[model samples]
Target: MDVWEKCRSWTASQLQETGQDCYYQVISDTFDGTEVTFADRRIVMAASHDYLGLSADQRVREAAMAAVRRFGTSLGGSRAISGSLRLHEQLEEQLAQFLGQESAAVLPSGYQANLMLAPLLDKDDYVFSDLSNHASLDEVIRLGEAKERKFLHSNMKHLEELLTTTRAGAGKTILSDGIFSVEGDICDLPALTQLAGRHSAYVVLDSSHDLGVLGPKGAGAAEHYGVQPLLITSALSKSLASVGGVIAGPAEVIRYLRFHARTSLFTAAASPANVAAALAALEILQTEPERRQRVLNLAERLHNGLRALGYDTGASTTPVVPVLVRGRERCLRMWRKLCEAGVFTAPMTYPGVRAGREVLRVTLTAAHTDTQLERLLNAFEAVGLAEGVLPEAGPPREYAPVRITRPTMATSTARGEEP
Candidate 1:
């Protein structure tokens, strides 16, 4: 009956004691986009979110260092108060233009970027969201206290059916993740926006995993679909190699959110170094479009290689590849084996994904060379074969999504093992 009661059961002591903990607060000695040194060993990294691999770039490092010198690291206040820098203004303006939006408001993180949408929803508003949309969108609706209706993942027919329940005059909003991180599938943005238009509902697209990674110009899902959403929110941490988030839309709409959204007005502004890092990364993203293409090509290669080896990589067309694993225990065992084989990948369970829908999260970045990628595939094959994740001694075989059979290993879902 105490406040600390719940946290008592959240400990990972059992997993650690049993040596079943493959990842949870594990220390990394050093990470340079593609390689991560940890546990006294250097391994090829396939778990980083830095999709364009700009984090370790000397140019990005220099930009961050220069900003630290100029702005003294922290700004100490919210952007609306004493924290707004000329650099912040420049970044916002440049981002808006790059994304083909009228204006942008920067936030401390992508989580806050989505939470700020709370102010846009009202009690009477009907919030239609995809089942697999990022957790932040769900929290925003809860905070907004709107009528929530979750349709199946990327199923527009279900979305339209829900829209039919609401009147045209109702205050309705459609929420979705441009790229669903768990399964590595792009959203049905074209169908979503069209449905919203018919119902006169506003659309909010969370492109946290899509920005600087998808679209013709890398402007994200909306740009790829040739349709415009009422607003787009994304993280700068991934492709931009920085630690913050941004929401872009029409000028007046952005201005309204800037003033009304407490998530932005109350939170301390993003650090100067982080903002500068994102701005510099953005510049590189635009000037060197080849990096974008290279990363996608590397991802498709990895995806094809895994599928050819008879693993189920569900409907992925992007760099985020989720190799669906079976049980929590077996998943950790496979991860440990891959580590022994000199590779590192992320482990996702329960809250990170659905309880039964566990996976070993593998990511591809432009920083990874073809040699390193091949090494990763070799490691996966070895661990997968040893773990009975794939058919033994089979001539390189291809498996369809539904055809791949996932074998469940007996065990537990460790505490705090969230993606």
Candidate 2:
């Protein structure tokens, strides 16, 4: 049999032949932050990670353009070799301050930032991770030489059990996402950090989806929980409106990773334009509180709207909202119909989720107008009713929106002390 036989006979190809594949189709966006054009039709963009809606902002665009004009695109080499720039250092310093960390190190991507931990670990170490964390965090555990254990998703009781009975290692680390992307759920960060402290395990919060959309100050999950982990990792591509990622923590750890980790030493430096744009977006995220506020307000709007429309929006408290469709084929059909109705969404299936927990992942931005949201809701109402995803929806019998609370008290850290 040909080694390529399985690739040639994949199920996705069949879905593509019938135009049911929704994953990689081109957007041909009109450059507006809130909408996209596809097949000559304008659609409200309900599935995107630009939480603060700064990716298409004119100020961000101008910063990117100015950087490109001055530095030309690529940095030409890795930072350890010849690509280190003063701008990179400046961004790191600013990020350190913003994240309440002593230091920060930038990487080529969030995936790279997640991978940074692997080089710092050994056979004597172990990592306990959430089963529902982002894929990048999952890869860190899977590829690392350290023994890895998966606790139940957000079950602090289960995590404590694993930490107590699992092999007593030379070192222990807990890995989790600030926002569990697929489930649209926020991690019980306070509980997780408390467990980490009791176990004397280091904590790593992967804040890929929450950097600019959570916390009163927009410092992601650490800030949200009033705790500082051993490290916090996040991507600029999501909220900072640019490419690349950063790991923020103590000065010693950042220094160690900068020199030892192949993620920073071997990978080419991020382009000047992307870095500058991210710096500018970070400035916006810091100064403009309204943007992140708008994101949460809009998220509440969408989440409550979906719940009232008789759809199961499972445990979402952030901008990432997942509307459960239950069946693979039904989920695909819902996505297709939503797209046809000028509303775009992401479809989650078996490998991305569990066997029966398929959903249409819907995300909103600060840039989306009320009319756009209403339009999206209307599309849902129409398609949901037509597809039997909804049954006689005027309002759900009981609708309870998740309320976000800002707890000012600090939680436990790696050493069982407040940072």
Candidate 3:
């Protein structure tokens, strides 16, 4: 065989041998709130990020259908050309207001937003990133190649140390997730904001998992901590139960991004139906604060219950709860068992998490009823105990502990003043 053929054969064999196969499974019918039917069984869903549960809400559906009736499916051209619609503008305005910013730019996807923003910075600039940031941010850093330095996950002291010591001239951006997707721990935004102020750095907040799940009014981490970021980027796909990304900041920054960001300039804008759906979702979020409270209540119940049942649910303070099962095979086994018992969840292994610290990532939605939450708790308790995977009762072991320390502000040299 020639070189190309040999390479293809090797790739295929490696995938097969490593159990890295990717395929789609068809759901028998539509998802009913927090339950889905597949393979002649009804499973309670614990793996969704639909925090407000607006994905199947009647008002959201009606808005989307109305848009579809008025405007067909596709946008037909990029946003700069014939794709910019009134709905897009309205959504941007609403998002800007909701995020407490002067303006916001909408993108097709959160991944694309990250991909576009990183390359916009100059080569001489630097990015101070968290070591355990989402893969999208990792891709951004790799693509930018802009003097990247990583602080330990959520370690503000380490971040400040890097910022003070690095010699990368003027432009510095601190990028982090407001709420980590996997571990579910909240970021110390106040400390980060103070550090950014001390170092004269711009802060970028990715609130993909926090937008509709945190804060009193579900306005996200900035509102939760009373800090305004230089730039705030998030996905509507997760908490908003829609499809798109938003980048909110000052008006000039948004205007510059609209004309220069590769993802916004090159790709077609979001379809009218999706834009409408997201708008409706936002309206519902503003009107119904109960949905947010319900999800938080359910999450707290689950977290406390799991601890009582002797399961190591890491330092999670949000709706994204992860049940730690140490090995890859054990994690997969627990996933399969949970599925067999009519509870569906996603298993995290290998590249998704560290090698030996696999887990079953369980997320909650507001649509989940009290009975459904109880059922999910029962299923986990049963599966964990039956499989002998539950840790012994008492103080839980630290599966992956994150420690954050604040940095002292530096004294300025001019006239011995503290800036």
Question: Which numbered prediction scores highest in TM-score against the true structure?
Answer: 2
Candidate 1 TM-score, true structure as reference: 0.92
Best by lDDT: 2
In model 2, pairs of residues that clash are none
Residue pairs in candidate 3 whose N, alpha carbon or C atoms collide under 3 angstroms: none
RMSD of each: 8.1, 2.3, 5.4
lDDT of each: 0.83, 0.84, 0.79
Candidate 2 lDDT over 1-419, as tens digits, reads 99999877877778765435776879886556689998789999887899999999999999999989998998889989885888888889999888888999988788999988887667888889998888888887766788888899888888999999866545888998998889878888778877777777888889988788777678887877777888999998999999999999889999998887877888999889988999999999989989888888888888888888898888877788999888888888888899999898988886688778898999988999999999999999999999977876455688787664332334533323322
What is the TM-score (0 to 1) of candidate 2? Answer: 0.94
Per-model TM-score on C-alpha atoms: 0.92, 0.94, 0.89
Question: Per-residue lDDT tens digits of candidate 3, residues 322-415?
Answer: 8888887778777878888888887877677778867788887889988888888888888887788775463355433322111122222111
Order of candidate numbers by lDDT, starting with the best = 2, 1, 3
Flag regions of model 1 displaced more than 4 Å.
13-23, 399-419
